[model samples]
Target: MVNDPHPPLHEYQRSGDYVVGGIVSHAFILADSIDFTIEPPPPSLEEVTVVPKNYQHILALAFAIKEINENPQLLPNVTLGFQIYNSYFTARSTYHATMLLLSKLERFIPNYICEFQHDLIAIIGGLDAQTSLYVATFLDNYKIPQLIYGPAPVMNEKTPGLPFYQMVPKEDVQYMGIRSLLLHFDSDLVTVKGDICTGEEKLENLPGPFFEMSMTGHSYSIYNAVYAVAHALQAMSSGRLHHKAMADGGVLKIQHQQLWQLHHFLRGVSFNNSAGDMVSFDENGELVAGFDIINWVVSSNQSFQRVKVGSVDPQAPPDQAFTISVNAIKWHSWFNQVQPLSVCSESCLPGSRKKVKEGKPFCCYDCIACPEGKIASQKDVNDCFECSAETYPAETQDFCVPKDVSFLSFEEPLGISLTCSAFSFSLITALVLRTFMKHHNTPIVKANNRNLTYTLLVSLLLCFLCAFLFIHRPEKVLCLLRQTAFGLIFSLAVSCVLAKTITVVLAFMATKPGSRMRKWVGKGLATSIVVSCSLIQTGICTVWLATSPPFPDVDQHSMVEEIVLECNEGSVTMFYSVLGYMGFLAIVSFFVAFLARKLPDSFNEAKFITFSMLVFCSVWLSFVPTYLSTKGKYMVAVEVFSILASSAGLLGCIFFPKCYIIVLRPELNNKEQLIRRLY
Candidate 1:
């Protein structure tokens, strides 16, 4: 239907404190007024789109006010009445309807000047934001409170103090309801970059079975808004009654208060409605009502059906605030009746992490495998984390594995092999010492200073035994003994070899007639060399112990899934210094033995000493780089192997020839073989 002026409306009953005027849109007009000429009266609206659901909003307001007047406990003797007006979905019609609601309703009385005029106390603003704002702005001048029953207005600083209370939840709540619907079906809301829909919309001639009394929609808001005013009026009447009772028997008067000032009474109103839902306002005068989630399904007749699938209550606990029924609703044909997947890339599995894609939204990402020494134990984990000190990432890099207490213990195969090596070398050194003791009086055994020979053999035996310190699980006492014992014992053996080299030189030099070096060729000279050299090493070891000693420690990061119990050289500098000093002794002995190797003395063992020193130097020279490169228990194994190998080299290269002569070639051990070298 097309119209340009006001259609006739049925007259109101004119009861209660004053009529509650409702401004609702029954139809939407197509175009805006174009001509800017001042037409004296407002522009007329035409070419409308009929909306049956909004027309029911007008009926809902009358129903609520009539229901409140029939209730015995509410507004007992004061009945409530209502008057409805058409907004016609236009600004001029909204303003005209609001002005008519506030003007005097009855004018032709016998005593027109003396008769009481019906004034609108409050207004239920229309079914959309534009109509609500128009009526709200006009009513604001008269200090009247307008309740918005449709969409909440997008108010800003410029429109503040307009004095309107929102009856429906804010527009953001509609978006949240949709979000909950998607989340309950295990899907995510996608980002759609598209153009805005700015065309005007009209709801008409497209539906079947449109409205129901039980449906919680915008029409329900109109019903609640009218009852809210009734409760405010009831509260105001009760306060007046209590004030009169407190006075000295004052006569009761009715209908004397200004209804427009009920804005003051409405502010203090808080009560439960007939539906048992509490109707209250926040500090900003907007009602704190949540939204009911409805599923609108278009049937074969092309009409949308509202099904209650969920509700969003802000008053509930945070975790329980939003809920939805997935099976109770229907999905679009594009989803194929199956729940839609989340609008994102496939989730990153365990042992993997998310790598965000460039030039895209944050949720869009690439799933990458976790790096070494770290783990991602959950799906779609944003980042991978390293395990704790006592744990490590599992082989799959999905979870943390507690580290086993690992060491070169006597139980494992490597530890058993090292232990056998140390023990066998120790036994061979002992037997060599015994063989030398049995042949002490022979020219071969007595040629080198016998006392120095005994000391050298003893030190070698101790060196082999010290390897046991590096075999077991490293402890406080063992850590204290491990490096120091190896250093001191190896230092003594190398010093003995150096002293013998010096003794052989001194003996050949002292053999000359009238030589003063004869006095120094005795035990005193060899004794001083051994004692002084060993004493220097002893002092160095003492200082190392006094400052920083080796301590037991665990290596966690050395291996991917194992923690190693090993000795931590407390002062790494001191540890290397000990090895350096022993190396110096070997080098000095090696050069001296090489120079004297061809000396014409049957007892000269300088050639063998040079070979032994060479082996010791080579083994340790390689040990430094290999030790630095290894990790965890493997490092301890390397140190133990080095100790055994170098000790075996010294014992084999130096003493093996003597053992062969003394045990198997006794004929060569006689004095006849001891040809003194002519100096």
Candidate 2:
């Protein structure tokens, strides 16, 4: 004997659920087999057989079931195989067969709602119309959904009164086919004469789009039926994931539930068939599709040889026939209208670009073109690029503007390029004038350490002016200009703070009047102090340029958007760098102020400076955590708050005491009196 190569399924399965096509059933192997003889099931007069005494009908049904099961209509991973019980082969034995099958396959069928009774799972054969009708009534009483092959028309109708979906064609579809044939012939006599002459009338009367008897309809019907079943199987397999995840053999449990799920899933599905139009069912469970219409050409032997008629919709009622009229022809005219094209608005002119209008569409304000040397690039651009010193915009009309300056905002939609650039030049001019005026008034600047005080006052003013760069609204050239001015002013402010700290430290260390370091404390020393601070400011600029420094703490993207340059230090980095640098200044200032306590009260300016450092440190230390946590517009709010607070403190520390002394006590302003009181 040849050995079978296929392994036994017993090894693959464990004691668990078997989900097949969405129907789940628990399988268990009995530990003991009971020897029981066949007997009538509590002989109830209520039980009756519905099939006639013809075995061929039973055989045909068996064949159909076998075909459906064996056909490759289910996914290979979850294929269905059928089991059979040969109920005794006679009409009366139909009930006996059901009972016998139930006993044999009790494991496969589910228990009824009434206390663990297995619902009989048996297929009944309908030899004649009576058997099918009887079976339909019987099944209806029991509420079992069954697949029937009975020839009775009543079986195809609502039997259980529950939803009875029929695969069989109804009488209406048959009548519609005949009407479609008359239309396709396009005969003038049929329309005008209204003569239903003999042979054709009988042909028309034959009640067709008959049960799809022809090879064409039969083939499409069978194909679509099997295809639909395959679709159900596919849905069942794919949708059973939640069940499968529960255990290794949860397929059985998933299968039962998903089977009905598969039915609902396929109800509204539409797919292309051999017929051109989509094949689908309407709200009522009926197949309404446009299939080819074929008419009988001649009778051969006993059967009719049907020829092609045309095509028609099977779902449409027969009384209402398909026709084309002038109204139908006129509907085609809609195709003539052309689609409109969208043209982008022209770009902003040389010095201008489009800015998002504050209130209305297509509304914009023209930006002032920086002088002839300046140029703009990009369309509807916010800002124009400035010509550094060498290059210029190629044309007044062209949008691709050029700039001589090597620097460009990393971000494109920057709004403050020109304003920022102008501000930087103004700051430089102011600083130069302030420096020159102090140097030129030699005698006056040298007296009473006035030059150092003048330089510090000028630095503070420059720092305050730099804050405007952050406004950065829509304007050509303002982007670059803003960054330069703000960056330069911030660097200068930091340098001035450092210089003050150094000045205090050095003054305390140089207590000896004849010390060489003391000789270096006049107008020349003040000039050196300014230049040294300027160098520190320059170093800050170099580092900022290399790193693509960030804007003052604000919305993360706002600085980039407004400045057009990417901020190197984002929230966290920005906080640490700012606090670290300021903290260094605070430490130096504190140490210097402590050491300089011995200095004469007249020159005890270090005390006020140290107090200012403490206030500044306290403000920023609190600002860091809040600044880092906030983002976007809220961050802008926090930054604005910080700016206002810092500015207020600085102004108060520098001017409040002097103002109080001057305004409220004018006599205190007298030099001799103030000096006498302090001493």
Candidate 3:
């Protein structure tokens, strides 16, 4: 069957060929394009197995394929199909299914792509981390991207480069919680470990002898994934055939793009999924770096009583603090960095290093290190330690032979050579900038020079990004970094605005015959004013933090984690404080422009500043409300909008006037002509 490009959709009888975008597509032109019929490219494998039946992965994949087939006018006439096999439980069963899929794919590969020329991508489902690991490797061998709706760290750990992507919290993050719990508990001599429960029979049956004695799994993760996907697909579906298909295609493609850019597919996209808080992955594709740890106590009857553990919200909220209990449970952990020494002392006795022995004092045991040049991440007394990268162990005794650094470079976890290179790069950039400034003084001297602004803005941007990373998902060192970066950027921006205002005031006052401030208002005054403004803001911030200590809450409202910290951006007072300062500058600049209207028309700097302020303020004012209204990726988008708009305003004000004169009034290029025209 072929679809006509100009088919009268209203008159055409409903058929299997078209899928609508929504439940009420009859009243809406949901689809705006034409569909074409191209054969699906091919399937890498004929029979692919989905382990543990991840509802969301299946749902998303199903909708994606359905959409490609039914897009109105997109592929005017095409049919796409998929074959799904379920790998219910256990690693052994998962392995069996993988082999079956492999065998079938071998037979279908040559013809599948040609037969289905239009369908180039295949989505495999594995909300189960263990199972997905096996499936991801299988798909990676074929150069396909597998969207795993499972934990992040598991996928990465199992196959780091196997093209496996995730839309859930990573296991590394889960470990973050575990590690935090261990540290917090040990520090205070609290003898308890957090347990995980997944509400699955298979997980329930799995033995826990090898891992942490306190670790267990729960069903909340699986539940959340299932319902979240269902909600998104439900919203995306249409009752009509054509529109429905188009929506599906659009959503799938958009989601892929978002994931590629390191955003979470569902939560990060700002899709409502009934999660308590609107969940979204951060820039690293991690929804939450730390989970709540509940200490489990076994009663005499064997019933477990789980006490609440501390919550780690990177952007902590007000009123939540580092506490031991919340809502009936004692929080045993909050994510914070544990020193390598805390885990095991850096200095060890002659015959022993650091090690963990399951049955001893807080699980501490002695570890032995071999003779010089030999290293291992883990070592226990009496057990032979494996040699670290760059060294190979000799069969005879506890000694290591060094390998060439080049050969060991890629394999080491923290490659020594690469670390040194990164440090050098930073040093070089700093030295070059310092040298340039020393040689070219105008950049430092100019009050509103474009070169100066550019340099400052670049540095400010780096500072902003660094601040984000420093406190991002807050652990130990991040706290200090976050605060410092925030203070620095706030100071810089405020200082810039203040300097501009002073420049305007001084320039206007200079027009008067007798004004002492005018004589003092040169490059030195501008620099001094800028520095003073920055220092003032910094002082205010420091005082506020000292008086009302802030905790870390990932969300601005700060309800999830019980520990909010003082940072540059989270507080309402901070927001208003900065806004107030900027607002004052804007008002003064406007006033200066109004007064300058009577002055010689050649002085249009005030007018330019006024224009820039209007745009800048409008952008920020609109941003506050929009930012407050959104939770995840959409909130992030609002910030992006504010940034882009502010930049555009600055660019227009700086360039638009010059562009007008050059392009529209070339005759005014001459200084005499420009002055005469302005007058």
TM-score of each: 0.61, 0.35, 0.30
Candidate closer to the true structure by TM-score (higher is better), 1 or 3: 1
Alpha-carbon runs more than 4 Å astray in model 1: 1-186, 189-298, 301-329, 342-406, 438-443, 672-679
lDDT of 3 by residue, 276-361 (tens): 55444455534443355454544456555765445544445533422344344422122122211333333333333455557645
Could you tell me how far off, in angstroms, the CA of residue 230 lies in candidate 1 after the best superposition? Answer: 11
How much is 593 displaced in model 3, in angstroms?
Answer: 4.2
Error of 1 at 518 (Å): 2.2
Query: By descending TM-score, how would the candidates be arranged?
Result: 1, 2, 3
Per-residue lDDT of candidate 1, residues 1-679 (tens digit):
2232344222111111112223443211101111111111222344223323334665666567667767877766665554455665667766666665554441222323333333336677665566777877777776777787665566788788777777766445545654665445433332211011112111222222211112245556777777777787777767877978736344323345665667877777788777887788877777776666665666677667777676777778877778767677675454576644435577688999989889866667899999988999887778999989888888889999898878888899999989998999999999999989987988788878789999999999999999888888788999999889988899899999999898887787787889888888888877888888888888888999999988888787777667888888889899998999999999999999898888766755888888988998999999999999988888889988988898899889888988988888887777765653333
Among the numbered candidates, top lDDT falls to: 1
Greater-lDDT candidate between 1 and 2: 1
Better of 2 and 3 by lDDT: 3
| Candidate 3 ranges with C-alpha deviation above 4 Å | 1-491, 514-517, 544-575, 597-603, 655-679
What C-alpha RMSD separates each model from the true structure? 10.8, 22.8, 34.1
* Candidate 1 CA-lDDT value: 0.70
What is each predicted model's overall lDDT from 0 to 1?
0.70, 0.40, 0.42
Error of 3 at 79 (Å): 96
Error of 1 at 210 (Å): 20
- Candidate 2, residue 238: Cα displacement in angstroms equals 53
